[model samples]
Target: MSHTEKEATLYRMSTAEHQCPYGLKTKHLLKSNGYTVDDQLLTSREETDRFKEKQNVQTTPQVYINDKRIGGYEEVRKHLGKPLPDPDEKSYQPVIALFAMTALLAIAASWLAFGSFLSIQTVEWFISFSMVVLALLKLQDVEAFSTMFLNYDLLAKKWVPYGKIYPFAEGLAGLLMAAEFASVISIPVAFFIGSIGAVSVFKAVYIDKRELKCACVGGSGNVPLGFISLTENIMMVAMAVWMFISMF
Candidate 1:
């Protein structure tokens, strides 16, 4: 059929009490695709239920073209030969949010403690708090985090228990750094883990040339396994070295 002849009939739920976002999206999609839509609004729960029963469909936002069923948003995309966005697609949003929040908290704490927002102390606090936040994200689902970590971490691959202990160790190091106490333990811990992490990431991304997800924040994270992961380890190493120098 010609583009001008292409037409769609959309049936969706719209009522005084509620409006379906999916329904709105479907209509917009049809219009964007150059289809003239015959919009059918089911204004009540009974009307929606009856329509579903009559159409033998379980969901709202049903679309049709030339009396041929095109389905909902997902199926419509498929019918138009468009790739549907994967729900499990990787994203850096979580890590970005964690770092942003940590920076804000660090600035607030530094202002309260040292009366300076842009001090060397603020950078220290930011790294420490960021580590703590990242560790907390992993701790939320240790099992999942460990599974992802084992994909590339040398220590985790060999000694599975290291994966389990990693979050706690990171959190302990972060807490110690934040409190400016127990440098004797925290320094070595941070240095050791950071060194190991740096090596593992280098081998995975550089040497092996593998495209993988980072388990730095958590197992479910979509953070890429390169720059951000390396930066995190480098921050730990830097913090450890700084803390050690401050001690002597």
Candidate 2:
């Protein structure tokens, strides 16, 4: 496409950004490309979440090229053939929301059940520690667990298969986490800290388009992988981290 045609083809960009340093570049990009922008500039609770859900955007400075989802700022710069801009520093609003919501839920439950956060914390430590140990063992013992003459659905046929079991291993970790958390546990703090590492792995897996099975509580049967899994894992990690930090 000719430069003018390319420029003409570019439509108004929809962006979700705060009044931050990075947001300035987004504004500059829009102006340079001759595209109008509608930055409603979300700050309050309702608007922020509505903006996020509407765009299905988990990160800041989300750019839609010609109404198609491109990505956040870096992706936009890459597409434009401009030297990729510094990775736009994004707000941790989503992470903060997860933490706040969990705390609120725990506090509400505690009030109704035990009349204090103290009881929740005490029981939570024991349960969390137990789960962490159990999850560790399950991961280390996967071969023995996966075998034992597996059958799909009670057809009484023995099947032995070898497949990478990391998803299940992660799921077991998540499950044990849930079990530990069921006491309305003191917010999954350790899970949160571990989540910092897990998020990187999760992102790599997503970029590679690897199918990951859900080993979380209950089941996620046939669900296409996406942000929810990452979010859940992060929440679990956050709880784990919080608990651990509180201990020190």
RMSD of each: 4.2, 15.6
Per-residue lDDT, model 2, residue 102, is: 51
Tens-place lDDT digits, model 1, residues 1-248? 78645799999999999898999998998889888999999999999999999999999989998888889989998988889977678777777888898899999998898888878888899999998998999999999999999999999899999999999999999999999898899999999999999999999999999999999989888888998899899999999999999887
Clashing pairs in 1: none
Best by TM-score: 1
Residue-level lDDT tens digits of model 2 in 1-248: 54333331221223354354445576577668766665545555566567677867775556554557666667767777778423333333433444455555556556666777656553443334433443444355565434321211111122233212433444455455545544233344345334543554365456666554322211212223345546545545665665556556
> Candidate 2, residue 212: CA error in Å?
4.3
lDDT of each: 0.92, 0.46
Error of 1 at 44 (Å): 8.1
